[model samples]
Target: MRIADHATWDRGFPVKYLLVQEDEDGVEQLWGRCTGVEGFFVDPVPPPREILTLRGCRPDGLLSEVLAEPDVSLRCLGDVCVEVCDDEKPVQWWTLADAVVVAHQPHQADPERYDIVLGAGVRSEESFFELPATSHFELFAGTRVAAASAGRCSGVDGLFKARVDLAPVPMELIGCEPAEPLLAALRRPRRSERDWAYLLVLDRHGAVMASRSVGLAITGTRPSVLGGILVDITLTDGGNDRPSLAARPIWAEWYQGSPTEPNLWAPYDS
Candidate 1:
C-alpha cells in the first residue's frame, strides 16, 4: 500500500517516510527507515503541500509520456502511496493498474531533483476528485526506481505500463469557494425552490479550493455524493466540554428552487 505524507516547510525539511504493513490477519505494523530525502513547494496548493499538481504528468487522457531514458521504472513513486488518514479509516482505497509515466528529468542535475509530473487517466466515474474518469491523476514524486533502460519513449511508447496502489491522502475541510469551474458542469433541476439542498463532496482533493458549490439535482464530489440546497453550521458553547464546533452540521430547512446558473437552468419536463 502506498502511503502519502504532506511535506510541510514550517514543520521542517527532508520529509520522512513511514511504511505500514497489514497482513491477511488484519494486524497492522509500522515500518520507518529512509535516507537522502527532500522536498519543496508543489505549486497551487499550500507550502506544506496538501494536493500536488504535476503539469503534463499525463498529457493524453489514456497515455503516459515514456521516459526518454532507461532503468526508469514506474515504481519510482516509491511503489505505493499512503494517503495519511486519521484514526478513522479513509473514505476510499483502490489500486491503479497499467498507468502512464508522462516523462522524467532531473531537477538540479548534480544533486538530482526527482519531483516530476505524475498523471493517470480516469477509467471509471467512480474515480476520486469530482474531476471525472477522463481527467488526469496528480501526484508528488518520491523514491528512485531501477528499471532496465533510461532512454526515450519512442520504441516502448505504451510498454511502460505501471501500477499504483494508492492509499488515501489525509484531507480536511480547509477552504470553500462559492464558485468553481467544475461546478459549471453539473446537472441542475427545476423545482419550487423549496426542495433543494447544497452539498459538498471530497473524494480527491480539489484542484482549486477546498470546496466548490455546484447546483444540481444529483450532488456528489468524487467517491461520496451529497445533495441538498443548504448546509447548516452551528457552534455550541461551554458545557462539560471545551469550546468546539459540532461534528455534524444541519442541512437547510426545506428549500424549493430551480438549479440556476446565473440566468440559465436546464429545462425540466412539466
Candidate 2:
C-alpha cells in the first residue's frame, strides 16, 4: 500500500490502495502461517484503510516487511498470540518468532485457510500504536510464527493481536508426543492461481470458518475511514467436517464530508 502523501507527518494524508505500479501484486505466485483458521484469509477487493509500520528493516539487502493480507487488520496485531494444538492438549503457547502486521487475501475455493499469503496476523510486539522505537527480530527474510485460534475474534470475525511480547510457555504447557501428521499440516504450504493461499494448521477434528470481502468502497474525509467496519471477525477454530456451522453476510461501508484517502485497484481479473 502507498501513502497518499509522504511529505507530512501523522494526519498528513490518507493511504491509497495496493497495486499502483506494475510490480505491486497481492497474488504473489512469484513469491509468497497461522495460529488458527482465523490467521488465514484475505479480501480480493481494495482493503480497508489500515496503518502499518516497518518491523525490522534490512540495512543492506534482505527485506523483512511483507504483505500478509488485508483480511488481517494492522491495528489489531497488538493482541495476537501464537499457540499449537494437539490431540492431548487444548492449545499450547508458542512465541511469535516472526511478525505479520497487515495484508489482504482473495481466495474463494478454499473453505479453511486462504489468507496466509496476505500477511495479516499479529505485530509480534505490541499494539500498532505502541511499537518500540528500537527494532529487533528478523530483518532479512520472513520468519515463521505459529499462532492459535485465539488470535482471531469470534464476534467480529476479525483477529486480535497482542500488544505485548509473547509470554513464556509453562513447563507443563506441552502436549503429548508430537503428532507428526498434525505438525506437517501446521507447516504445510498452498498453491493457487490467484496466490491467495494459506496453510491448514489444524487437526482433522475442526472446521475453518472464514469470510472474504467481495466489494471495494471508501468514504469520509478523515485520513482513514473513521472506525469503518472493525472487521470484528474472531475466526473460530473448526473444520469443514464440524457437526454444525453458521454464517452471515457482513457489510462494511463509510461516508463523511470528504473522501480523505485515495483508493486504487488494478483491473487484473474478474
Candidate 3:
C-alpha cells in the first residue's frame, strides 16, 4: 500500500510527503515528517524529482504529464501493477498477484507523515457442471452460490472509504464572484439567480480569505427534476474554520418540486 500527505503554499512549493493512519472508528490521523526542499515549486513548470519509463509495460508518452510523474509512491497488493517515480528519480514500483495495497498521505505540519495506500484483490477461478452421461466432467459442480456466500468467505471484506484529516490552513479569499464557470460546466441553462450564501472575509489587504469547510450555497432555480422547480445546492464546509466569505453564483441543482409521496424518501436516509 502506498500512502502520502502533502500541502501547497500560496507561493507554491514542492509536494511534500506525510504519514496518515485510520483508527478502528474510521478516523483519519495525519503527521508531517518531511519538509520540501526550496525551489520545489513546479506549479507552472514541471519539477525534476521524478520521471517515467517504459520498462513495466507502461508505454512512454502514453500517460498524462500531470499523472506521469511520481508526485507520490504507489503499490498494489493483488494482481495489479504499480509504478512510482518523481520528476527525475524512480522511487519504488511493484506488482502483486493476489494481494491488497493501502496508501496513506498526511497533512502538512504534522508530527508524523503517512503514506497513501491502495488495496487490491483478485477472485479465485472456479468451474461447475451438471453430472450427466458425459465423458468429461467439470472440475467443480454445484448450485449457483449466493453473493452472501462470497462475502462471508472474504477475510476482511468491506468497502474502505478513505478518511482525510484536513489541517487548519490559512485560506485567502480571492474574490466573491458568480460561479458561472461551474454552472456552465454542469450544462444547466435554465438555472436562474443562483447565488452563494456565506460571509466573504478578507485579509489585511484586499486579498480574499481562505478556510476549510466554510458553508456556501446557491439559491435560485425553478422546481423541475426531482418533482418541481426547486433550487438544488450543495454545501461543502467540513474542515477547520478560518477567515472566509461566501462567493455568489454558486452552481446548484434545479429541483422541480416535492415528491409525490413521503415514503419514497425513507429509503434514502436508511
Task: State which candidate has the highest lDDT.
Answer: 3
Report RMSD (Å) for each prediction in the order shown: 23.9, 26.2, 25.4
> After aligning candidate 3 to the native by TM-score, how far in Å is the CA of 123 from where it should be?
32
Residue 121 error, candidate 1, Å:
2.0
lDDT of 1 by residue, 1-270 (tens): 222332111322222222133444756332221211111111121112121223322222122223434544442332222121223533322222233344455544332333344343322213452322222233222222532212111111221233253322222111111122223323243333422221222112211111122122222223211223211111111011111122111111111222234523223221
TM-score, candidate number 2: 0.17
Q: What tens digits encode model 3's per-residue C-alpha lDDT throughout 1-270?
A: 123212322332222222233335756433221221111111221111111221112111112221234652343222333323334542333322332223233424442322223343322122222222322111111122411110000111221222233332221222111233434423553333322222322222222232123322222322323232222332233223331222111100002223455554443321
Off by over 4 Å in 2: 1-73, 97-100, 106-113, 117-270
In model 2, what lDDT does residue 16 have? 15
Each model's TM-score, in the order given? 0.17, 0.17, 0.15
Tens digit per residue, CA lDDT, model 2, 1-270: 222222112332221111111123543211101111221222212123323333222222112112333334442332223322233432333233233444434334443322332233333222233222331222222233532232221111222333433322111101111123322322453332332222222222222222221110111111112233111112122112221211111101121222245542122221
The candidate 2 region of ten consecutive residues with least summed lDDT is 215-224
Q: Model 2's lDDT to the true fold?
A: 0.24
Which residue runs does candidate 1 get wrong by more than 4 Å? 1-97, 107-113, 123-270
Rank the models by lDDT, top first. Answer: 3, 1, 2
With candidate 3 superimposed using the best TM-score fit, by how many Å does residue 215's alpha carbon deviate from the native? 9.7
* lDDT against true structure, model 1: 0.25
